[model samples]
Target: MSIFRNLSSRAKEDELMDDFSMGGAELSEALVHLRRLNKIFAAPGPTRYGVEKLWRMMGSPASLSVLDVGAGSGDVNRKLLEWADSRGVELHIILVDLTEEACQEAAALFKDEPRIQVQRADVRDLPDASADIVTGSQFVHHFDGDELVDIVSHMLRASRYGVVINDIHRHQVSYTAVWLTTRLISRNRYIRHDGPLSVAKGFTARDWKELKRRLNHETMTFSWKPLFRYAVVIPHPLKPGGKESGIGYA
Candidate 1:
């Protein structure tokens, strides 16, 4: 085995890459650029744990509008809706993605549902869009320095309740997992390169802290999961443990 197999997860998968990032194909498995995207929509170890934890922690999801800025292949959106259905939480979703290709793909997943709408749009800057909950999974790791700051700022400004950003944790272990997982699980070239590259470029908890400082520490909560190799919840301030306090981290 390689030394990467022995490194911390944070270091391994943070820089993984997929086909989209590598320009290997026009389309492929959602997991190609789907590093963090999977857990948002589906359920598994850390990803499921994070979403479920936030659901119980928040206590009320009867009225929540969710915005997935970089809605890739509708993975996150589907998972959010599926969560609502299973938990009895009623949610409205606004799905925005950078490419229409993603829109076409996402549309298939949510085509029958009127509550979910996929739009070809950019989420780099969160507009005047107000949502009770703002969530992005595995998506934000695509940024570097100033771009990351700008994206987070835009997200913070738009959320009235809170935000949940499920993203890769920057580290060596994370890089390795991304590489191995892609190699073992996917055959798409785009997913392979972009997957590991994404891991290499991931962010750590410290980065989010810096974002909080720059954004006035507006009542947020942060959790980093080791297994999933990503940040689970970074929430906005509200009455702690209050059922209807309108505070949530998804």
Candidate 2:
């Protein structure tokens, strides 16, 4: 529970914990509005900044690949496409999620684009592998404690480049901002419920530290970007010769 305090935003989901926030037409509507909501209410800085940083540090994305775990509706994937296009980098995106309907919707959005692939699966059950970069947005907070550690390990193992988890920071200020923003801009029921719930389940830098300590590797770093009432977390890749990569490995 102490770790739970680190992610105060998740506390609000108490009223709506049963909602999968995925499935059926409601899920589709949430997916649509969420993309709009993120653009208007939860955008990640000036777009190419984070990806740019990774490229500068890692060399190039000319051959980079990315995996979006729990890619609800391709909003993040859409952003990735934009980033790749802007940077002249070739990106191969694998979108995985628990709900087939959501993944199917995402696939429809990018089916014609050979660079993207979608799968209906739990991230935890997925295989360990490597990609130039691995990323996820608005989805990490759904995991806490050991579940969070396991997911991070999966990301680390699956990425040859790095892992970037962009989500909300769990704090009173972030929670308030999100709640009000959802009330003001979005009109979906699942959005209204899952929006605040996401905040409550979010992780703080301190919580991340505890989770990292549990891992077999000792060379991971965690970077935080708390902006526009949201949080951008970067978990760097583990060094092949070193114990493991630091945070923001994506």
Candidate 3:
């Protein structure tokens, strides 16, 4: 258990050798494992909750556009779409990832999903206010410091409604639990290494407070969710009063 708390601090680690770029049957299998992990742990639920918050804020718009940053395999986007559909809300999802392979995979997965589009692009380079809301799940932990600021800023800027980021919470219990669970159910080397690594790279509540202070954005809201996940939501800037209003915090 002590070994699971090996990281010096909440600082980001170097990017793991993610299997999404391996470009073969191996990548496909790795992605399958990744999707399974997200499903088993219900990683996308908090992101959907964030979207629900934004939807209510928008006066329950008939349609919404969401940009999912670092949308590996776009599983989160798929779940979000399903959630909106159940509520009779039309959803258009844009899946963005740095790896072309990831984009291609998402595109293929959602080809039947006429409302979904996939793009390979850097978050920093995305144009401003491109979607109704920008969402990411298990994504922000991959960046730190200036890069984290840039990503969050870009997500907020791209969302006409808001930004929702769902990521792990860095804690010894969180890390140890994921470490044990992944080892038991997953044989993918990437999952075994990156799962715990992701947890370790995740932020503490204190870290989120400091990050919000540094960003100096008045509209941003952060809360801890079930399953040791953090939900960070930044409401639309055009909203009256310019503060996160009415949305319930977890």
Q: Each candidate: what lDDT?
A: 0.60, 0.65, 0.79
Sort the predicted structures by TM-score, highest score first: 3, 2, 1
RMSD of each: 5.5, 4.8, 3.4
Q: Give the per-residue lDDT of model 3 (tens digit) for 54-142.
A: 78877887988899988988887777878887999988889998876677778778888889888998788899888888998888888
What's the lDDT for candidate 2? 0.65
Segments in model 2 whose C-alpha atoms lie over 4 Å from true places:
1-22, 45-50, 216-219, 226-250
TM-score of each: 0.73, 0.78, 0.88
Best-performing candidate as measured by TM-score: 3
* Tens digit per residue, CA lDDT, model 1, 1-250: 2424332323333333322353224453543346343543232334344445555656765655777777676564555566778778777777777765677767876788888877776665556646765667666777656766677767756766556677766677666766787677666665666666666556777767776676666565566665545544555554557553454344
Give the top-scoring candidate (lDDT): 3
The better candidate by lDDT, 2 or 3, is: 3
Candidate 3 segments exceeding 4 Å error: 1-3, 17-24, 238-250
Compose the digit string of candidate 2's lDDT tens values, residues 166-210: 666667666677777777777778777777667777767766677
* Model 3 lowest lDDT segment of ten: 241-250
